[model samples]
Target: MVNGFMGRVLRAVGMAVRAVHVGGIMAGYALLFGAAEARRLLGPRRAGHGARAGGLHDGDRWVKMLTRLGPSYIKIGQLVSTRRDLLPPAVTGPLSRLTDAAPPPSRRRVRQAVLAAYAGTRWPFREFTWEPVACGSIATVHEAVTLDGRRVAVKVRRPGIQWVMERDFALTLAMMRALGAVPKLRKMPFKVMHEQVGSAILRQLDFPAEAAALAELRTNLAGLGNVRIPEPLADLCTPEVVVMEYIIGLRRFAPGDLDAGTRRQVVQAVLAAVYEMLFIDGVVHCDLHPGNLYFDERAGLVMLDAGFVIRLPDEVRRSFADFFIHMAMGDGWTCAQIVIESAAHVADDCDVAGFRAGLTELVQEASGAKSGQFALAPFAGRLFDLQRRFGLFPAPEFAFPLLSLLVIEGMIKDFDSAVDFQAEAVPVLRRRNMLRDRTAQLHK
Candidate 1:
């Protein structure tokens, strides 16, 4: 009884200390950014000095604070970067660049974790490297060769990471709750957002779940012909460790690195695969950032990391498909109606008429814009802003599907600026029967 009491006291004290430390850093940065914005607004305007320049500066500081707070903050930042509606372009722009690289734990710790995961069975690997090939917040991957001489990647969870992340999330929840006392912040659903993110992060600790996702995605994308998903070794996968086929020669490439024809082929394949996931399969991969995506001449488009996948409900999938289809056909009223009908929450005092009018104008402007004139990032920002203005909140389901596309938009544009993004979706929409006769007439 005494020992248990002591443990509880220690845990409480630790949490308190963490709260102070985290709160101090956050408050400091908030003040710094506030002052910077004030100065920018009051100072004389110079050539090339404007909100964009100031925003970039503030973005750098925000990145530094997140990095300093460690893995949990970094992961949250990466997730928040996708919500273009919540933040400005300058901020989300830098947050999107946040990488998950961290130094690997000691080799001894990794070996112990691997052994603990396979306690009852004989080791499957004939050769295993003690050193990690890559290290991220939750796990580190090492190269290994199976008894049958097939090479694979073995991912081992970091020791004690789950407890650490749980503690961090608890602190984050507390901080968010305190922030919620503010009237403006209270309406934003920050608590709900944190809970969703916390749940996703916790689920990522389950290697078996990720392994299952990899298998499901591989099967779903098989018809695409140009995408590759690593095959998880089922017999070797455990809650704490996963073994998968190791792909080679996967590297980042620029638009100039590939021939024009190859670029078109790769971009089209990627778009088709993403649309299939969002519309047909309903299994969307949310983390398609550059680090998780690579190009191989032979493999085509190689996608890695299935830890952040989300399965959308059939209704949500159909709603998103309808929204895109209507948007493509220049039917702004239909697009606005789709958003309202699919919204997760609408304030009691929501300005429905204003929202409808604003969204109609927004969608029509986007649809009529010429190639190279419309961009998804800015459009998403505006869409979210409009929602915020009218107190309408889109379903969480909308964010991940859009995130999948936003993460790859820059790369797609770089590869082929003239590519018609809206038109590309017609094939999938038609396949799903989402393109009604109205769409048929427009396409014709």
Candidate 2:
């Protein structure tokens, strides 16, 4: 093993090589695809030559490119997909299809991690299947049976993942620093957002924190009869591995498979749980993608992966909830003020009136002609664009939860559910405000 400055130098060099390799792959695809599109546009308009014939989408080539680069690249693609505010639907839509699940570690590595956690080769679990049920960048989860005959899922962090993740993030930060010098990119909140996201991903490498988050979320959501969080086996959990009650279910929602009543129950349950997290709990499971959320007709929704939870300060929570409430009510000026207050950086000469006027027009336009027609994702996307013009930058506290809400709203809409996000979330906001007011009066 390497140590001291020598190790740092080696790691930096390795990251540079990886970056060049990945960057080359990305640029190659861009050039090839750009040429194809140019040919199609400028050349003869052949009857058979269209987007479908060229590929599933123009972004399809990128999916293949990123996938070929390996797990870290795939994870990056998945992360970028959540940025609906940054990328257009055409770009992110294809990226969302990039799967996080990968091939499991070798049986020897899996058994060794479990043994290391248990402090010996002898394991407590009666049946520890070498085959993993799911595999991702940070960890792999396998199905196992405890000695007491309890069905549990054992999640083991991949060996050397910490080192890889550290190097990758270091490289990411360096790239961001390089990009900071660019005139156009300098205005974006890349540095702050990257710091927050990088920290969250690093925290996820620690399984004990994940177990704690899962338990706390279960306790917080206990009253919601429809939501389910798997019980973590505390005695068996370690920083390297976590054993929890196994939940076997299908991925994402399939409306045709379930009865109308069941579908409504499922949709309502998910929305209510999300609303409560945003407004009441003040902490949320920041990664709300479909893969982490499972559905069972009888068990309701099974939420997995607590590694990326975000805790909001009370003031931030209240301001965020109120912002949405005002947005729902079509009070864009108030929302603008709330955003300005939450901004990490605001220009002295920023035009508050111009922002308010533009945002009001956007809100009214997105408010829809009637109920059930408005969308929160598009509205939030416009706000992201507004930040560029107004010199108001997002703090991590605000950006993370806002992105979480946007992702959840997109999931709800994907199922063609007519649930009104503002209408549903308004009650949560009102209730939270009422409780706050009551507590304040009591304190006085």
Candidate 3:
């Protein structure tokens, strides 16, 4: 039919437009890389522990470009900001400020997603706010009230987000392939990083998972009287929408806004809660940065954004706990041993002795640092790099907790410089070990 022929023509035209749009963004990134190469050739060289001579200028530009490119790229930029191993401080430091808040979806789209999520099931919301309370890369959250008068937060996915994400990921992988061809970049785990992060972003698209994670966290963290997680309304949640009981906060706390005592309490509460998540519960809220964490004056530190959760197997969790405990205690040999045992693949040609030496030296350097001066992010990043050099590829589960640690370390440092991380974590580590021992004995 003539109509079918016209439809085919329209489809082709639409494909062409999308290709051009994506191609234009790719071209922008290419130009940025070209500038980086030019800087390497012509600019003054800088050197230091984490010195990146040419990358400093590119970081802000990358941020701008990612922002303009839309949600998927913005999400990647936020993730890459935390990846100190893949990028230098000059780049990651600036990119760390990249906010996840994006423009909100139209009210019409919100209504459609909400109706679909609650289709044929006694509509839960008595009143749904038209304007969004929060708009992030994955979804926009609106304030709503249940039929029974419970205040809730309804997170609605942006229309066509998944399709856009898929398109952008394909483009990103293609670009990675092109970049990986360069000899200097060949050894870097671009594919692993891409696959890991891309998969995480995709997984986050599942709102049901987020809802489940929130419920699991609430149950697991019940003992932590001060810490809070938003309560999920299980029956109302769907893949595109998560409806959770909302907690009212007087305000999100800034580090300097609180007194020293309050700050110390907040930091300790966070450390204890997060330690439980990693060592005991075996599930972690992978994104625990400042923006995702809030202080409810009455309810303690409130953790948000449960989309990027990671679950570790029992063995992996035990090894991770042992590794951190040893690292905190300055036992680099034990830490290195744990890492070797935990790695996914160790090359035949790996120099075991050399790895041990490097690890020992690295740990010594870090543990010897003065209080408030030690940086765990860079330390963990260097450890990752060392593992790569030894041809040891760690499991994705192993890397995520380290990234969480990096985020937590930064948050704690901002709150209380005087708080001794090792001393504070030691008690929790001991408690975890004690529980493990008790469990082992019970099984025997």
User: Which lDDT tens digits does candidate 2 get at residues 1-444?
Assistant: 457889778877988887787688878887888787776565546544443323224556667786666556666676666555456677677777663465466889888877888895457798988888777666788899999999999889988777667767877888888898898677666788789878877888778889998999999999888788899999999889989999876556445576666666666777789889888997799777755787765647888888788888888888888887777777878888888888877666567777778888887676653656776666677887787787677677787777677666656655545767667676678888899899999999
Worst 10 residues of 1 by lDDT: 47-56
Best by lDDT: 1
Candidate lDDT values, in order: 0.81, 0.76, 0.77
lDDT of 1 by residue, 29-127 (tens): 888788877777765564344444462356667778887676687776675665454467778777766644555689899999998888989989999
Ranking by TM-score: 2, 1, 3
Report clash pairs, candidate 3.
none
lDDT of 3 by residue, 175-209 (tens): 78888799866655567777876787788888888
Q: After superposition, how far is residue 30 of candidate 2 from its true place, in Å?
A: 2.9
TM-score of each: 0.83, 0.88, 0.83
The positional error of residue 317 in candidate 3, measured at the CA in angstroms, is: 1.2
Model 3 bad stretches (over 4 Å): 1-23, 29-63, 79-100, 175-193
